[model samples]
Target chain A: MSTIFQDLVDTLRKSTLHFADTKKLMNTLNIIVTIKQVPDTAEVRIDPKTNSLMREGVPSIINPEDRNALEAALALREAHDGTVTALSMGPPQARDALEEALCMGADLAVLLSDRAFAGADTLITAFTLSRAIMKIAKYDLILCGRQAIDGDTAQVGPQIAGFLDLPQVTYAEGLELKKGGSLIVQRGLEDSNQWVQVKLPALITVTGRINHPRYPNLYNVADSCDDAKIKIWTAKDLQLPQAMLGLGASPTTVKKIFEPDRKMKGEMIPGDERQMAEALITKLKEMHVI
Target chain B: MIQLVPEKCIGCKLCVKACLFGGIAVDGKVPRLTDSCTGCGACVDVCRVEAIIASGEKTGPVCDFAAYKGIWVFAEQHAGKLHSVTLELLGKARELADARSAEVTAVLLGSGIAALDGELFRHGADRVLLTDAPFLANYRTAPYERIVARLICEHKPEVILIGATTTGRDLAPRLANRLRTGLTADCTGLEIGPEGGLLQTRPAFGGNIMATIATPNHRPQMATVRPGVMQARLFENKKGETVRIAVSEEPGDGLVQILKTLAREKSSVSLEKAEVIVSGGRGMGEPKNFKLLENLAGLLSGEVGASRAAVDLGWMPHDHQVGQTGKTVKPRIYIACGISGAVQHLAGMQSSDIIIAINRDPAAPIFQAATFGMVGDALKIIPELISQLNANT
Candidate 1:
């Protein structure tokens, strides 16, 4: 066969496969939204002695941006008539955030909790998540928050994409499904916004600006926690190797943690607003800033 | 652990060019693995067709990490413009490089931006590796990661730094994954550690704690520094050599398309540039009341800032937020109005020269750090202060 004939055949073959894939994608979306439960950052505090967050009394919530991820998955499901699965990795208590996702109308909730998964860094976390994702097959889309408020590392989603070897669109602020299972997305960057087109079976890390998550209903919250709707998976359940899912698998280790000293003893100017404002402006003048 | 989904390949030899081990061979449009494959996943990224699986990867001992020399910075450029964090990294990198008698190299990839290489040297880089190609105009993860990873494999650098901006957050992880190396993100401090490894210190657990991380066994220790965290060395008149690499212009995988791009940002009064920042919180009542802070800022020639609460309340935009999740500001004076000084809010602005709190509650945490504290209604105090400042100025 001529080289031109072979090239044409390859292009035609790829296009037809994509066209049929799009037909299936348009009708339904099997979406997995990954979320992390974190200590409410507002009340977060660090122990000066140990140099770590004092999570003892601090309450945990779904990491702020993860709500946007859940909202994105729910929106896609609402538009395409499909199942939305909320997946979270944390201690057993992290199940609360997954239940919240269920309350918000997710079809399935999963909590990957086990003693073995403790102290796992982003790389190990991505490894464990990818194993579960692959085990639960037929997922067409994966959504994640831009970053976790606790770890503050945005690496997991992209690392998961790397593990699964899938194309990824990060900072996905807007999305529109196109014909043939392709998607038009608006990505918010540091300086400007960019619109890009990507195909299905893709991963996206969304920012909080993407959408305001809907509140969970009172009745739905009760139903979501029902045993039939939520499943708890351990390392063995996912058949994940013991060495690959925990602190032993982590590549980076913290040598030390310390509280940063940001305090400065300052002279308090006592007074009402009028007197304080006068004194502040006077001090600015004394410092030659006014 | 490295495998290839042969069906995903498009007969592209880009991966063949990427692999330094000479282990990936293409025949009949499919890649076959060889015993020599070092499992260095560099080819994983370049194969935008997503054919290479570098996962389940457990690193077997790397070549002596000490063999890598020189400190390199990824000089980020967008639309022919450079990010300031690159200059900051160059400044710090120069110090580390000199301490170890190593050279400082800047790795820059963008179309038609090689001409800006001289600026990199003025800031501290000894050499700039320039890769220019039309396909490099818009920042795509695969192409950019491939070029950098391929270069790192060829010319091993002891340390690599990237800006922790949006592009950095997206690209750095992919590069680290491809190299199967350790990456520390949003590092505020970088120092040469014991045994010559790079010690990266960053605020972890929501800025409540600082964690010092070290990559003891990884080559080309990689870290991303957030913009404004490090001071950029002042530019000097100096000449630097540039080594240009010829990049292939082939459209990568054609997996993602750039449908449209918004233009560059307009120049606005940024909180980072403000010397005096007068910020309001939810106690400001409504968005319209923010005008009081704006008026005071105008009289003081400062910027009006907001707490995450105000931004969340829709009283202000996220850009105006001054907190952990928002822009960190080190203004000369930060006046708080009705903000209770939540830890998240204080994490971004506690470095100010002087803090003044104006909450009605005397026991608000904002008063703890404030040089001056006032007990009053923010609504009444703000308007009166705005009138007083306007009258005085």
Candidate 2:
């Protein structure tokens, strides 16, 4: 698997070289991939007694959508010969996700972890990420998942774009190198899709349709154990004021938490196949579904 | 209670435009707030220089009569048709309305929508507030906000409920900002306190937790409930009285109108109205695998949905994504495949009539909400389940 990946990388490098002097290939590329670690949703269980999710033993993994973002970055790096950096803000355990990105071919990894980063809503999260990106400086591209599985706000990407004052291409499915250091990309809208040409150093939030991410093979997995080196950054490293890192930075706050009211009790309409179908149909009709 | 620093202002006038209440005016090159400034902080978001700050005070006038009343639901309409979520909100509103003996009124706005007044009555509205005008024929944010804001100001309804649809989501925040009240968006539950305060509940922290909020000191506590979260009232064939109000002709131009709107095409999957929904998650592994969900949905005559995970993965379209950032669906039967029931994902579909969870992990949080649970691999079980469903069909 390692040989295949190396061969693929070589092929990509050669192809990119062939396109050299093609105005789009002239500039240096700096790519930032944003990621997160979330509990495997399929493994999470709600404790009946507590009426809350039972998260204790649930396995945590890199957010599935973020994996796509990483793959897109890796592919871009392989083609354009650019540096791909992985960045994440989470608890200490989230370092594991950064390590995975390194194994997937990222050149560098940075984890934004600190107690001061806790209880951040989307607005604060965007503020922190934008500040961090600004500190990183001279990045030609920014890649992010359309939304995180945990928060599902889908606001951070746009909000970050707003903060950075960069034109954003959201829900991108594909990209092509264009003339004059510009990229022609496809953006998926609600009713239909449209293509836009954006100058370099732009922010893009990707949807899942871009590419199939390659799995880590035995050799890469083994090498990852030795090669993985993550740079840990805190509020101080990013040079952000203490008040702007966490809950205090967030304008919106969650005032209380409660279980939603369940109006109808689940009733099992049981019987043989035909009987069950009839019962289901009858129930649907009674509920005005017909 | 939001304040702006004059020195830092770039004279962008974004705050002036964001102020729903016409309280802030641009004086030469600076934004000036009046005594009518409600302190809602709606203008704070438009400050590019971070000049506007929330003062954290209850700075608005206290409507004494509104303090004693209960919650109210505004039934929104478009093109003379009442939005389906209106009835759903009425059902939820009835509960809170009954708690405080507060009458549930459905505020209808549109030209010639008075004929549909009986529909709201049958669906549980005690009174219908009607405002008809040619300007309302199309949903322009300014006109709708004006009528709704005027009604709230006049009637002094303690609580206002609106469906979190495109129109509702757009109008609610503006109205709340104008009224100097707090608004909870995409709420799934609502409760009234003994003091007639509204406890608005919604999923937060990416759906990891549910948050209940209230405006303790504000009147006309506002909330926007997503469609399908609340059950629609059983319809009865009865008419209710309609009180008509005059529509204003003044057009407020705060923003640019660059493009004319064309006719919108109908969506392929109206999951919002589906009786059964079969949704997939990242567990499906790849975009190509979403075909299985589509096939299963076809057999069941249901709509296909995806968690924000799957949608973000690009396996499905954003329109099919169900969550806080995506569309909220309340089907009668929701079959979750490889969906871990993340708080964000569950917030969108938890109100379904029957939930069926299919995952390898028996401890999947979706199982807690599922009425029937099949603890096994979705890839393996879905094919078999699809076959069984097909045979029965």
Q: Which candidate is the best by TM-score?
A: 1
Candidate 2 local lDDT, A1-290, one digit each (tens): 33354444445434533211221223367888888887775565556577676778776777766888889887877787777788899998787677667668776778889889997755467667776787677688888887666544455665565455454666778877655767776765444455666776677778777888878543333323333346788988865555545765454456666654432334444444345445545555576643
RMSD of 1: 10.0
User: Tens digits of per-residue lDDT for model 2 on B105-171?
Assistant: 8888778787887888888777888888766775645567767877787678877888876556546
Error of 2 at A191 (Å): 6.7
Error of 2 at A178 (Å): 22
Chain B TM-score for the candidates in order: 0.83, 0.81
Q: State interface RMSD in Å for all models.
A: 3.8, 7.2
Going through the candidates in order, state the TM-score of chain A alone for each one.
Answer: 0.82, 0.83
**Fnat value of model 2:** 0.13
Candidates in order, TM-scores: namely: 0.85, 0.59
**Candidate number achieving the greatest lDDT relative to the actual structure:** 1
Q: Write the per-residue lDDT of candidate 1 for residues B1-393, one digit (tens) a residue.
A: 677999988887767765656778998688988877876655654455657766675453255666799999999988898888889889999988988899999999988998889889899988999998888888887688778878987898888899988888888887777666678998878898767788899877766677899877667788988777777786578778899998784455467778888865753759998998999998888899888888888877899899988998889988898877788788988999989776667777877887888887765667767776777887877777777767875
CAPRI tier for the interface of model 1: acceptable
Assess candidate 2 and give its lDDT: 0.69
